[model samples]
Target: MGESDLIHLDVVGLNPAIVKHEKQEKAEFSINRKCYSHLKKKTFATFVASKRISSLWHCCDEAFSDSLSIHRHVSNVHANEVDMLISAALDQMSNQSEADDSVQTSLNECQAKDASSWMPDISHLSEDKFSEGPGEVILYYRYCQIKEPRLIRDWQNELCSRLHLTGKVRVATEGINGTVGGTKTATSLYIKAMMAHPIFQVMQVEDFKTSDGGADCFPDLKVGVYKEIVPMGVDPDVISYKLAGTHLEPDEFHKEVQSLLNDGSSDSDTILLDCRNFYESKIGQFKNCLAPDIRKFSYFPDYVEKNLDLFRNKKVLMYCTGGIRCERGSAYLRSKNVCKEVYQLKGGIHKYLEKFPDGFYRGKLFVFDERYSISFNDDIISDCRYCGTPWDQYQLCSTDFCYQLVLSCTACRQKGLTACCPLCQVKGQTSSRSPTSGRVHKEECECTNSRPRIPTDTS
Candidate 1:
């Protein structure tokens, strides 16, 4: 290709000024180098051809001549970007009345180029780096538009498998929420990889809340595409993070909690709310915060709907385990328009304890893993269910069919107070013990009544 043809291909749809500058520079250089201009043109054509081939296989640096191999490579590796581009093109076409096949072809070419521009080279991440020290568990979530969740899920599965990490990852059209545990080096590399990804580039190092643990913290890796990353049991399109409450940094949240504590009056207009479930708060929670008695996160909407009077005209300060719940929870609460104002902890309790280990939050932070909970301070805010002894350790109910977690001190546990309640203990004794019987057919206990099912709000 000649200089003008190469320039046109390189600067297609780019700024007119940039194209003009490129032409001017070419003209200036060509005047004195006319003798070798033909050779330069041949070299440029070869370079451009190789560059185009490399662009087509952006994920891996391999260039394939076979169309089938190229298709396989792109689908297996760059499926997420491909889906995103197709979705964008469709969206653009839908908005334009005169859009045709030519318009779509042009749009796809432009979007593909743009997508490949931001893809980072992960070829060097072939080997896992092992560290000597203990591993860490990272808890993080990002709310952004993901055009194809399944492709993201595939990518996450492959990445986590390669790093030998274990944990749960929930992907949705709205975003991704994950808590992976691995070696210090592996976790560090995972964070770097996530930040390098175009979809998650908005994330910072601090966004991944790390705690002392490793792959063993979780039983296995479970990554899946879901309706909502956090499963608020509401349509993500209806209650999105965009409509979430204002975020307050750890310092600001600390001050707000301190202010609430300082105010001894019962009629304060501001309310400190724990957005976590009852069990989570039972172990540890902010001092004097109103923790709802909901069993599952899905019930949060009903809890709010029923208790609207409590939040009416009140400035609500909300917090959760790692901030994922509060994102959609706060949005749901705000949708009611009952509260005067709604604000959530920027990074939730995790970020709060990082800054102030002995801050307003007290006791152990509950986590959904084998570890059960991680402590920041020496505070034991909870008590044994059987005896009112100060304890925060959680153990599963001894009843085989019951999945409920109960707190029983050493003394009580030794005395066979292992069930969630006395009734469950009696039932466990009378019922036929079968090895095959599991929590899937869980018998209703007294605690079951507390979690009354509410119709899902599809609105």
Candidate 2:
């Protein structure tokens, strides 16, 4: 056969079998042959050549050897004309195959399949529904080795910014810890993104503890790479989470706490230790738990050092706000070689409250945000620091320089007892009087000095 006849046979006969075989014989040979004939007549190469010689202004005289290069060229240079060019090319291909009935039928089937594939599957979008509210806040942390924390930090910053989230995110080689607030949709998206991340695939939707609040709960967005996701004032290299305490689920921890409560013997060997700071435990804590009086988390190491006798040969149960602190805090306690055993609440009070809101936990759960506390039950355990009335709400001391929080009730606050302590009140009054006071620096105060050297009995 002549070259033209050979080309026609190759396009019409041989190509069909190849295409049919590749499709696992799904398409009949007759249909495949018709498809190939249409494709060969309106080949992409012919389309590229036609475009090069057309009256349309081209960016450069360079010829592309492949479709990818041509696509790149068109996208980079004639971006504004991309839709027009695509429509023109589709019209040209359709016109070439309009005469053949079999070709038109095959094209219709293929176009239907292609269109279905392009149509987005909205099945997974239904999972995005959250509680009906203006917004929400998500608290989550993971302890895994991250070789490139800076990359993770950058990704977090970009993701949170795009979602219009406001909160603090800390990334380290160990992992990431954050509590972000945004619209329910945004928070839901953030959770999905975290679950999809390669480094954080181990995380589940349950790992994220959500509460009612929004972007307004925080002042602004802050994301950065840090030495430790949760600052414990100890190197993670030395006190690793791998050496941390055994994890107890909410139910398991509840049972354990119940057992502790039931045992009235003085020889009870287990101890419930609150790993959170004083300001946190001040409002709420597990019944009879030994809560440290340290102001900041960085002071925890020293507290453990000085109070080593308390945990000596005892089974210690440690817990914190969202379980991140207890991970490192338990590790630090374990490093001291004093405790016989250490166990932590798996998801902390956050998860426990979800499962058992009205269970053993009482009062409000202190959170680090504009919403100072969140409550599950209306149990008033703590009293106002000023009037001694039952109150659990916390507010920042009115003194600009003092960072202490005041547990003063609304009644006391109305009576101008907003300061954290007498020293803070005196300082605030003095600072407000002098225009040239220039902010006096006070290091030690009654509030700091009055903190118990050891745990006090709250029962």
Candidate models: Cα lDDT each: 0.73, 0.74
Model 1, 399-442: lDDT tens per residue? Answer: 87688898999999899889988888987787645454444656
TM-score of 2: 0.70
lDDT of 2 by residue, 67-126 (tens): 356757765776445434433533443454443422323432433332122222235554
RMSD of each: 15.8, 20.0
Residue 75 of model 2 has an lDDT of: 55
Tell me how many residue pairs clash in candidate 1.
0
Clashing pairs in 2: none
Q: State in Å the error of residue 117, model 2.
A: 22
Clashes of each: 0, 0
Deviating ranges (above 4 Å) for candidate 2: 1-133, 436-444, 453-459
